[model samples]
Target: MNQGLIPSRYAKALFEYASEHDCDKLVFERMQALSEAFASEPSLVKAVRNPYVSRRDKIQLLTTASGSTEGDSAMTRFMELLADNNRLDMARDIALAYLKIYRREHNICLVTVTSAAPMAEAEEKRLKQLIQRHLGSATMEYNHLINPDLIGGFQVSIDNEKLDASVANELKQLRLKLLN
Candidate 1:
């Protein structure tokens, strides 16, 4: 009954349905775009969540906004599902859950690296290679971030696993050691 659980459940059902219909990839991509649009457009979110708006009007607006997109059916079904469950407000959560399912099914991992300074191309390449070697797949996506508070060195995270080698982390460890 948790709010987040509802979206994930709906997303899982939709994923299975899409897979059965052989439109999983297309629907997943469309859902991702729709979710991003919904997140970026405050007006769209407001309109969708407005209780006074008729269901038909909401559907028409979504259809018009999506215009000529190839995955209209999947989106339409998803919208209807949300409306029926009175969960239109959680559309973004459903879309994100669907994307997470899609990525897991496709064996994709998102890796993030943060450092005090931007990494050189060669350094990035080396890190990518190392990550790929460790993950045993060349299908990793990397995001880089510069955080000056790190002071030096870098940190890497792949899903829930984290490697922190930042100067700030080292200093904290040293301070703790001395305190103990």
Candidate 2:
């Protein structure tokens, strides 16, 4: 389902709070960790959403996922608030929204490349250079990923714009055309 404005609103509120105390950077780091954890582990979402799990347990899980120290008040308080409101299930979405907000605030573009297999260092360097030529001085954060299901080829995304050249995608399009 579409997240709508709820996650964005939560993210903004958190960002504002962090900003008031010059802790936005810290919060961004925490959110980044949380977002990465959610991406790497699908089951974390389920655990957060599970009604049987106690709020304390969920908070502990979130703290651990953030890789924070013994107790970070901001992170701890935020988790508590989420748990209290039963909004923990939306934590990942909130974290992702916050990331976009942070990147925009910092004038950083997030570039991600996903391929069937890991690209060679030289190939990756050339790809990044190609991207830099197009971006023209925009500060960028690069992320590389492997999705074997792509079958072959690569996909590059600069912020919201995407170039898909995956064999799997081509096959899917061909299948649709043949069926029609």
Q: What TM-score does model 1 achieve against the real structure?
A: 0.79
Per-residue lDDT tens digits for candidate 2, residues 1-180, read 356587898899898898887889888999999999999999999999898999999999998998766657888888888887778888898999998998988878899999999899999999999998888878879999999999999999999899999999999999999999
Q: Pick by TM-score: which candidate is best?
A: 2
Model 1 over residues 6-113: C-alpha lDDT tens digits? 999999998999999888987776776767687678798788889899987786666554442544687787777777878877777887899889888888787999
Least accurate 10 contiguous residues by lDDT in model 1: 62-71
Clashing pairs in 1: none
| Segments of candidate 1 deviating more than 4 angstroms | 34-71
Q: How many backbone clashes does candidate 1 have?
A: 0
C-alpha lDDT of all candidate models, in order = 0.81, 0.90
Candidate 2: 10-residue stretch with minimal lDDT: 1-10
